[model samples]
Target: MTLKMSGFNIHIVFDLLAASLSLVGTYLAYTWRLRAANAMALGKLSTGYGIALVTGAAVGGYGLGSANLILSEIPMVGRSIVGALAGATLAIEIYKRFRGIVGSTGVIFVIGFTTTVAVGRIGCLLSGLEDQTHGIPTGASWGWDFGDGILRHPVQLYESTAMAVFLVGAVIALAVRSPFFLKNGFYLMVGFYAAQRFIWEFLKPYTSIAGPLNLFHFVCLSLIAYAIYMILRSKDART
Candidate 1:
């Protein structure tokens, strides 16, 4: 559909808003929820995080560029958020292992990340076929036209809804202080998000990296495996 608003593209507006608000929300969430964690582990958290950010962005950019996904060809700033998340997770795990930092440092980020993705995906939906995030043609009643003649699956909206559900569920888990959930909240979030994304990847009209899966599909599988390992390892450690 032609998502024009007052002579401006609504998708661009949402993208800008999402980026701005997500940054602010992430900072606030970190301060409000992880201040104590930071205080307790004040050993180069900032420096390590800076390194992690750089490495994550690099890895993500490389993945997207190599796979030719969306905007990975535009200089150095084009990268998929999904790739960034996968790379960031790996980088953070490496940093944690090298520094011997223990415990879940990403609890607050669970909500922050989910909320950011949920908001940002609205822009992807509005961008529609112009953006590579659009799904393949479908005949469902809920499918969108996206300025194209063929109706396509609204995968962006599906992901946004999934992220929203995860955010709400995570908050409730924190409020209840579920032992396992609190302990492995980050893993749980990653596992759930990756699982959902893996399913949605099939709907997207992207180049496949393997026989039947795209780059994101492989990334999501890796995330799911890593999350499972983390959860199991945490259990074993407790035992």
Candidate 2:
């Protein structure tokens, strides 16, 4: 049941690869005229928006990530993509409200963000137990042992695969000029990511915050609610 891997820490390599691929994908999406309007609009945003996004993402990603580890009594620091998304959303919303900007400004990021996550998780998987992103032990035939002899659910791959599928679908939607995706792609991606993450949390061994739920469960729920509210609000505005 033990899955053997190279001793070298290749997480950094995959991280770089993910970043490179995301950049390339974003550039292609922009140049190919897929969601061109949104891409151009995003490019025209003031520098303040970028500052807010980076600041919020940095703080939230590390803050929530470290807090979760502390709560779980694990002596380590980490980063959470969910936290980054939440922070970025809050920061962007505040910026938009102050500047009177409306509608989803995140459409341009859907593909790149999804690509980053879909590819970055492979780093976590290869990082093995030290990454602390592995899942609880399972007897399933596909379970992988991260040098511990215990067959655990490969939760990282599960998430990666889910996001990859979503990435494909989103790309296709963009290619076809799907109206729903054009307007609500950002919300759809956020909701889908949160929903899938919520399901996968059950397979992780993180300490429970409320009975069966962990810190991530609450974060996921908040994100799902936010996405739903935004989508509904957009619909109401149109009507």
Candidate 3:
């Protein structure tokens, strides 16, 4: 029942699906950003800004992913979307500081990212144990056997469900034009996602970079910290 290429299998399908969703998300993000005052304000600066942000994020994501691949005995577990988020965030901030651009230019990406992850995880879940996103062994009826006989926590589902909830909340917040959401939506999403991912990492058997914390645990904490800092900064800026 498993599809294969070289030595890999059907997991590639989900991986491809994730990549496709990311592309879709990128397009949606670009279009949605056009409605933002900050986005429009970029004007002639858009080209350089776009290049800087993208290059930075891509470099950061690749660097971190490479670090994981080098350090871990496991294959696919090294790559993480969180690493990309962290990379992108860091790069964007550096670029902004260098160019003196301000305000949350990342707001438009919040929902788009959530949608991408939510859709992408579907592929991860379908990829099952081979994807290395599976949770620790669990006796619960809700657990999925994956390819193994032992039932395990469906961590992929847990993350996907959390993102789905956030997505719904984000949509509603936008519909109502909530001032707080409008002002600091990106920070809110990052903080919320970091919290959820931090919790879920406990279920994952990812190799610990430190004593008990995996590479992602540190990345998640960093994300949470950055989100908090950004949220507070935004609030202060408003006042």
Candidate 4:
């Protein structure tokens, strides 16, 4: 059902909250020695690597998101976190290859990225039908009515909860100094996010591109493959 909270838009509020929380989390992680100083150093925007990430994420987020909406015949702008991740991955890979950089430079962003998705999706849920991220109709007891009387799956919350669970696990892994997370946490997070997004796509009403799969299905699969390839090819894996 629609929330009757007057005045401010809940979606924008949550977006700000997500950003603030992500920044705080990143700062705490660095200050508390949860992430390596060197890795965090690489995240600096002054570096070319950071520029590539921002460029790729912006282009991909808008390009792919808008492409999906157009393909689905929806007359509105869109943005996809999945697209941003994929774009950033491609950009960073190219930069690393040219600069002879190796291993994952994305470990510093794993928690912050996860935190954004986990918290930002609540805004989507509250934005109601205008957000265009609602799930297909469902008969489940927990289904919500987003302005329209039809009970839908509330996939936004489902995704948010899933990422929140992952965030908890990631925090614990960091706290314990898990070697796997220290070396390959970025790949792990990408793979997990793609896997979950792939599943959630089935519950969405987006237009199908291949039989029953939508544009995001292919994107998710590509991300999963990318993550796997990177993890397998990592120097840590060889050692």
Q: How many pairs in model 2 have backbone atoms within 3 A of each other, for residues 3 or more apart or on separate chains, i.e. clashes?
A: 0
How do the residues 140-212 of candidate 1 rate in per-residue lDDT, one tens digit apiece?
8888877757788989999999999987887676556576765688899889999999999899777676787
- Candidate 3 clash figure, as a count: 0
RMSD of 3: 3.5
- Better lDDT candidate (2, 4): 2
- Which residue pairs show backbone clashes in model 2? none
**lDDT, residue 231, model 2:** 95
Q: Which residue pairs does candidate 3 place in steric collision?
A: none
- The segments of candidate 3 whose C-alpha lies over 4 angstroms from its true place after superposition are 1-45, 75-77
Decoy 3 TM-score against native: 0.83
RMSD to true structure for each model, in Å: 3.5, 1.6, 3.5, 2.1
Q: Tell me, by lDDT, which candidate is best.
A: 2
TM-score of each: 0.84, 0.95, 0.83, 0.93
| Residue pairs whose backbone atoms clash in candidate 1 | 1-146, 1-147
Please, what is the whole-model Cα lDDT of each candidate in the order they appear?
0.75, 0.88, 0.75, 0.86
- In Å, residue 229's CA in model 4 sits off its true spot by 1.1
Task: Please identify which of the two predictions, 3 or 4, would achieve the higher lDDT against the true structure.
Answer: 4
lDDT of 1 at 137: 88
What TM-score does prediction 2 earn? 0.95
Best by TM-score: 2
Candidate 3 residues 97-189, lDDT tens each?
Answer: 888877777776777788777877767777766666778988788988776587888887888899999988987777666778777888999
